[model samples]
Target: MNQVNVFLRQRKDHRRWVALFLALACVVAYATLDRLKYNGQALNHKQMALVCTAHGLVAHEHNDDCYDEDGELRCPLPELELHEHDDSCYEEMAALVCNELESDGHIHDASCYERVRDEEPSCGIENDTHEHSDACYGWHEELICDIPEGEGAHHHGLGCYEIQMALACGLPEITEEHVHTDDCFVEIDMTPDEVEELVEERGPRRTPSWPPCAARTRWSIPPS
Candidate 1:
């Protein structure tokens, strides 16, 4: 190679090595700083992420928040004991921690468990209060038993109400044991007949916690 070309090539190689070394150095520095931040008792977001990563959890930008493979929020530690409605993280709990931290507007329910924000908030703590059925849907209800087979498809053996509500599904293969709750309902300016027609046309849809009303407010929100 010509001298100039050889010189340029060497310079390019040198620059590449410098960049690689700098990147490695930055990583090391970051790791050292993160470790140093954890003085003794607890961890911040970055340190929590490292610990969570070690335990097969995805660390998020939010402080001490992590997710499991299924995208559900997870506890950071594997050994922190919690009681009363139980901690959502179970390990490094969020409810009581948020209280000590005094994060604006955060509150624990009578059970001492933090209330779940919205059904789809980025990081709502799981209360682990509700039991799951084989398959659950609308009305926030659960079916402990599966829908009965061909012989008694219309009848859900027990813990289900068939008289007040009919199986919403039309397919013969469907066996339903859904129980509708009356705890809460949204009101709209429509007659019963109109609502029924609208429901028939729109089909079945579980209500989402629209507008994240459950989110703890650091500041008051004006209603739309």
Candidate 2:
């Protein structure tokens, strides 16, 4: 009888262990399934949403005019809910524009003087008593000079005056004159033919279909 009782207790323990293992397995499976469903839903949402610039041009908050002509004119990506400005963003754009204007030679040489500062040697004329001196400086100044304060020194920085002007003017509408990209209206980076091809490739979402798209697309929201 003692031996039989011991055998029964062992059998019961085995059954309990099996039940526990099965329960654990079921819990793991449920968790996994839940995770998969969540992931799938997220992916679906992303696929349905529209893609836009970092400034959230398509976003409704800041009034940025970003839109989508491609993929069936679907509403702007829902993920881009907020539109805000960034500090360096405008500055970087200004730099890009300045570089472009300087390249075109439409602006004066003084506009890009800062770019080629180190290309020339500086002359020591702090007290140049001549009226014609006018603190004359040029591009490509390699040697450093100790000119008096207020002397014309090449402020070779990231951008030039023309760039600042372009930024101030703001981006133009995307059209035959100014091909638009995901970022901004680009005139210098690509040639005419290349620009056309890029516009076609990026689709209407990037360049937009109208000449006044840029003005319409300006957003008031700041960067997220």
Q: Best by lDDT, which number?
A: 2
Tens digit of per-residue lDDT, candidate 1, span 1-224: 59999999999999999999999999999998887765432322222112222222112132223343345433333322222221231221112112221122423334433333234333333468855443332233333333332322232222221122122222122122222123212224544455458548956543222121121223221222
Off by over 4 Å in 2: 49-224
Query: In candidate 2, what are the lDDT values of residues 1-224, reduced to their tens digit?
Result: 99999999999999999999999999999999999987775554322123334332342332233332242433333322332433322432222222222222233234333444433335645555743232354555232333433433343234332223112224332212211244542224333455457557867543323132232122222222
For candidate 2, the 10 contiguous residues with the lowest summed lDDT are: 215-224
Which prediction has the highest TM-score against the true structure? 2
Sliding window of 10 residues with minimal summed lDDT for model 1? 93-102
My TM-score estimates for the predictions, one after another, are 0.19, 0.24
